[model samples]
Target chain A: MRSTKPRRWGERLIEGAIKSTGIATIVFVLLIFVFLLKDSLPLFGHAKQTASLLGTRWLPTSEPEQFGLIPLLLGSLYVTLGAMVISVPLGVACAIFIAELAPQWLRELLKPLVELLAAVPSVVFGALGVLLLGPWFAKTLHLPVGQFAALGSLLLAFMAIPTIVSVSEDALHAVPRALRAGSLALGATHWQSITRVVLPTARSGLIAAGLLGLGRAIGETMTVLMVTGNAAVIPQGLKGFILPVRTMTATIAAEMGETAHNSTHYFALFFIGLLLFLITLVVNVVAEVVVHRMGREAK
Target chain B: MSALPSAVGRTLTQTGEDGSQSAGQSVAEEAFLPTCEEVPCAPNILRPEGEIKLEARSLNMYYGSFQALRNVSMAIPERRITALIGPSGCGKSSFLRCFNRMNDMIDGFRLEGDVLLEGNDIYRRDLDLAYLRKRVGMVFQAPNPFPMSIYDNIAYGPRLHGRPDRSELDQIVEQSLRQAALWDEVKDKLRQSALGLSGGQQQRLCIARVLAVQPEVLLMDEPASALDPTATFHIEELMLQLMEHYTIVIVTHNMYQASRVSQYTGFFLMGELVEFGHTEQIFETPRDKRTDDYIRGRFG
Candidate 1:
């Protein structure tokens, strides 16, 4: 008993450390939610002002100061939808090639290279969007200004590809080898087996992958703020992709310092933050549910 | 049991080349053939019979540096059950996989000499793998049903070869399940997921899936080893019924099963075919000492 005492003490210390860290993550998320709710609650008291904030315009500095969120909401929607359109098909195809078709040596080389893409700083992507893509789009598309919603969308798509590829690749790899053998022994070609058997088996995981990528694209602020010209106009249609616009994230990031403390604008920014947090939470929860169901079905 | 031989004979003659063929020629072949009448009791000896459905000529198999089979040669007869039995790692399963070239998927697997299906070299460079597999289906030891509807599981094979219309698919599914003796239990629940079935039913569903492709031969790798006793009996009975049409090559560790179900039996030991003969002769009469020892339970 005496000899085991020191080892038992060390085990208790390590267990306590792990438990504290796990609890710390939950406590931190709750603290942020409480802070956002406390700050945003004040804006709901001014009923007329709050009602005006839902109208078409967002002229924050004009007479009486409008704060319509329609343009900002639409801008975020357009950018995220554009990014998903570009990333989902490309990322899924890349993942299939890596998981099913690549030779062993090539697979080994490509997996780490894809993971390294996530390590590149978001600021670097923002800088590239500002210095390179913005000017290129302006010149080629005949736009008056280089910074626009399309430029931000393109940069955000590039940023989201690594997440989509890695997650979906893991999903594809999770399909059992026995299913492939069964298909092949039935005289199905390799491509047929992959498309019909493996892809259907891994469907939920693939959906989870796409949703996580959407969360990443929607939450990204730096690249959109740098490239999207911060115009507070509601875009009209598909043609609005080339027009200047501002996302909710970019609006909060670009204007928070300028607003006075405890003002309507300040509380409105917090309200947008709360909305962003809720959207991200919902997407993450859905992805988690899908992944859990996939694990259960695989068994 | 008394009526089975004539019924099997009538089916064989109905599917034979022509009535104009000389009776003497067929009798010469039947001298070697083990009739269904002989299934219940041992005969003196039986020789190679009828047409050779699958032939392995001086074949050698290797996985990288280790040799799995060496200079193995055997001719499996048409419309019969041939059981390959040995202790584990005797290369029976390896030899069975060579029929459909399933070993091709293993990394560094290499084969020497030729494996022939219906007298055509299966390993020829121009041979289409899809067509070959369609003609020679496999049932693995463990049941592997796709996580789909039972109807879809049976329809998957036919859909791969051609786009069968919905009515044609339904017909094929029903016919295959009936052939596998699983139709009565699953007829109403064809749309239910195949994964919900018991282990034996899942195995039968796998067999039905393979049959939907209309293969000429079925390669069974210990097909009933994973089932309970009643399920094993059902599978053995199904194999006996199926031998009236399809040529079956089964690998088994059970000596009594080989004796009970197979018409011809081959004893394999350490990558070589030690003896091959009528199942009755191999069990009752001892030629090679190893064969005698193995059947008498002296040593594997």
Candidate 2:
């Protein structure tokens, strides 16, 4: 019992370093967020931008200083709605097919391919959307230019789908085998058990997944910039729905290059960035709440 | 002969269609309905005990290269508690699962011979496995409630078949939880999350969920094995009570439990039915030496 025990100083130092690094990373993210919020305060007080968030035009720094963001807000909403409509069914169906109905060989093959979709670079997706979907929409939908809301939304759908599929597939797979067996033991068919019991159990997780996909849909930058025509006009009709629309990320990205420091327009773009940040944060928080509710429901 | 009465003769007559009735060929139909009992040279009679609701006749099962069960033929009676008593690896649990085709989930699993329910082959391709499972509900060794409210867990089954009215769904949830002896504890918290319950409560909740489906037979695979002594005793009592409506088949390694709860006891060893008879006979004077040895703590 009196035997001497020794610990390596190097090991202690290395462990300490790893913990400090993690804490530092957390602090770094918080600092950046606070800095961004501090940088975007002017848009809230500017007379010219008074109705910017509520107004239809977005031509800032012009004779009238039209800093209204309502059209941009609508444009963002329009694209996000379209992305959700496209991604939700496709993602959940693929997840169910992979996790439940796919043949063993097919599942093994498809799972990695779907997961790989998550790792593909966002900029690459944006470039491909611009090259492929933007031109096709402009030609087919009769948009004045190639980049439009429809093209951006379709690209966002592609980006968001992998997140939904992977998360939902995990949720579906997490449902206890006993529940399925219990349903089966009670004279329920395979499809019946899956649809009735399994899906209901996975509802909360599926909601979280959908919210996360929505977050990704809103936060995407380069793709929105490439496909959204960056138009300042309020769109009219189908053309409006598919017109070159300005979005939060696109406005920030396009204006940040030419914007002058201390100028209201520069702060306006920063405010837009802040708004994007808040939207994604809200989406994530909502997702967490839904997932927690699901966990409780599972219990 | 004494345990079985001649009422089963009536069931035999029902099996004969009118085509054979006019020709007095009823005895011919009796031959097709196989049995081990001698019917006094008469045909159309139903033995009260021989009315076997479910039977595993010369059943053998294999899991890949491993032989999991060999010739595990046993009869399960209606509305009675029959406990399958055996050591681990004796295939008692596997045999229990066969009642509802739960073994279908396992890969490379094969079964032989007929598993008959009401004299119908359960393994027939045409037979709907879903319907088989519905009639033969099972509880696992561990508690596994769905990720849902205690109420929704019970309501899930009825909701699946067809849309039931709101009040009807409410009544079913209450009745099923009450049937599983958990209503008093959970009635107020019916809408609360199920995972919030304790392990034994969760197990009972699972039982309640199973009961909601209105299964005619309940197969419990060491249902109380994961519970504390008090919880175990409660489940044992619940099993006895459940036998009034649902024929209960329980697999338990506890010899005392088998004798305490079962009307009939089956002793399995090395995947074979070592002895199967009335509980008193199996406990007092088993006909087979292996059964005596097993009951006396000999090698499983």
Assess candidate 2 and give its TM-score to the true structure.
Answer: 0.85
Give the per-residue lDDT digits (tens) of candidate 2, residues A61-174.
687677777777777887888889899999999999998998899999998898898888888888887888777767887768887787788888888999999989988988
- Our tally of clashes for model 1 stands at 0
Question: Among all windows of ten consecutive residues in candidate 1 chain A, which has the lowest summed lDDT?
Answer: A1-10
Q: Report chain A TM-scores, every model.
A: 0.95, 0.89
Tens digits of per-residue lDDT for model 2, B81-189? 8889988999999999888888988988899878888889899989877677778888888987777788888887777666899999998898999998999999889
Interface CA root-mean-square deviation for model 2: 2.0
What residue runs in model 1 are displaced by over 4 Å at the alpha carbon?
A1-9, B1-47, B297-300
Q: For candidate 1, write residues A1-299 as lDDT tens digits.
A: 25644567788899899999999999999999999999999998988668877898887777786778899999999888888998888889989999999999999998888888788788888899889888987898789999988888888887888899999998998998888999999999999999999999999999999999999999999889998888888887997888888999999999999999999889989998999999999999999999999998788
Per-prediction DockQ comes to 0.65, 0.44
Interface RMSD of each: 0.5, 2.0
- TM-score of the second chain in candidate 1: 0.85
